[model samples]
Target: MLKRIATALWGKFESTAELKKFGFLAAIFGFIIGTYWTLRPMKDSIFNAIVGMDYLPWAKMLSLVVIFPLVIAYSKLIDKYPRHKVFYILISIYACASLLFCVAFLNATLGLVNTVQSPWRLIGWAWYVFVESFGSLIVALFWAFTTDTTKPDSAKRGFPIIVLFGQVGNILGPLLLNARRLGFANSAPVVAICAGLMVFSGLLFCKIT
Candidate 1:
């Protein structure tokens, strides 16, 4: 029966409290991952649209150069603040940045329609790095925090649930953001939605704590 399948997958929870904790963790992971997946395609598409695909390789190289310092700064941040505080701070910062990008994308001169020029092209590169770092940092931060807080025994049961929900997010994120439904090729709306999701993911983590 379905009960057997559920037990086989998630294992039996010791109590309702344990089950609820696992559910919240799963939801938080799902939303974070979903937002990342949604942003992933836009990183490349928006970059190519605004900066020209010719510069794509250089933009990628820029990310490699940028990521080392970023990781070091992230480590210092973790040392200075509690993990939850780091999570809230990073999520808030990304949310605000996303909104800023959304507004920039709305501007004809600075947005996706502008011809690829040196200074204007900088925004495209920045956008690329922004989403790239977000994927690298936020996902890693979630797992680091999760494993830090979750007990090994409970993790055996709960991790599967979290992974399953994350996969669902991975699938649905792109599906729901399909351009045909959204009815435009502009990235501003998608960026705005991502900001909202990031805020929601932070709030969900608040509930988890």
Candidate 2:
């Protein structure tokens, strides 16, 4: 019975090994994409709250300015090192940055730092820049890894299923946020959760074969 459902949903594989591999890769890809999607709304909301909708154009432009050079550097790194190593470096940096922001924002919420002041606004701007840049790069790397790892045949069958998982993540992220409105109210915990998802997805990425 379950086999029928599995086959109906994911299609049949020639062997158990193929089935397992397809599921594994699909899961990793889905989580990676989902994690990024989750951050999308959070970042947008925080940017709107901190700087107002009027300033979003300027923030996006600034994000492009910051991301362009980093993208070039990342492309060069891909040429110089193994892709997995590059993934590790990038994800680690993102995770650490998230943790730092989590701490900073938490302090601000607790009155350890003044959030209604100049430096706080500056920090919010920086967060907006990082979020925009990271969103583009992470999604690009995920698809790149997907193409690199998936056989053409498997990808044709499996990519859609993987994307479905990502869609679930996309739906789930916002629902989770809505449920945790208190976290979203401040932005710090939201950033922390996004960071944790990135780290978790990175671990899963490492395990992909």
Candidate 3:
């Protein structure tokens, strides 16, 4: 199956050199997610502060609890999907996850999730944690896909560059998050747009891979 995907995609590449370039392109684009993700914590703070200080810690706890389940599910998911397909799927998930997160957070901001001393506040906390888990899961999946996609030789020569791209992605996440902090449009809308980008990338991942 991998060979077939390589064949279909490589038809556009006349030589090994082009394959290397394609790999680099994929690495760069894939890693760009890092940039926006790294800055997430600060955004969470702004969101929570705006939402309610009382709500933040419980949300974090809920998010942590959800990670165990998400990680378990993703470990199983990785076993079943190919590297390229996983990347495609993850990118789409990441985009959607980001959008949902924006929605959850923004809703919190506008008092949509506000409980006003109600028990539902706990549920709101869980919802915050639940949304964060998806973003976390998508990142973990994409890193696995990156490592799997690189060949032995590429690992030697390209891993460094790819790793750097990942670092850049890490930087980008915070930057984008901060940008949202600077009174940009709603986080939900921005992340929703990213979901569309992920879907587009998934299509390319499916066709070429």
Instruction: Output the number of the lDDT-best candidate.
Output: 1
Taking the tens digit of each residue's C-alpha lDDT, what string does model 1 give over 131-202?
999999998888989999989998998899999999999999888976657997676888899899999999
Residue pairs in clash, model 3: 34-169, 34-170, 35-169, 35-172, 35-173, 36-172, 36-173, 37-173, 39-173, 39-174
Segments of candidate 1 deviating more than 4 angstroms: 1-8, 115-120
Q: Candidate 2, TM-score vs. the true structure?
A: 0.85
User: How far in Å is the alpha carbon of 123 misplaced in model 1?
Assistant: 0.9
Position 42, candidate 3: lDDT: 38
TM-score of each: 0.93, 0.85, 0.63
C-alpha lDDT (0 to 100) for residue 78 of candidate 2: 83
lDDT of 2 by residue, 1-209 (tens): 64456678777756666666656666766666666666677676666655556777888888889999999998998899877778888988998998887786667453224534333476567778888878778778777877887788877667877778778777777666452665445656767777887788778766663
Error of 2 at 150 (Å): 1.8
Q: What shift in Å separates residue 140 of candidate 3 from its native position after superposition?
A: 2.7
Output the lDDT of residue 63, model 1. 96
lDDT of each: 0.86, 0.71, 0.56
Question: What does each candidate score in C-alpha RMSD?
Answer: 2.1, 2.9, 7.0
- The predicted structure with the larger TM-score, 1 or 2, is 1
Give, for candidate 1, the lowest lDDT window spanning 10 residues: 112-121
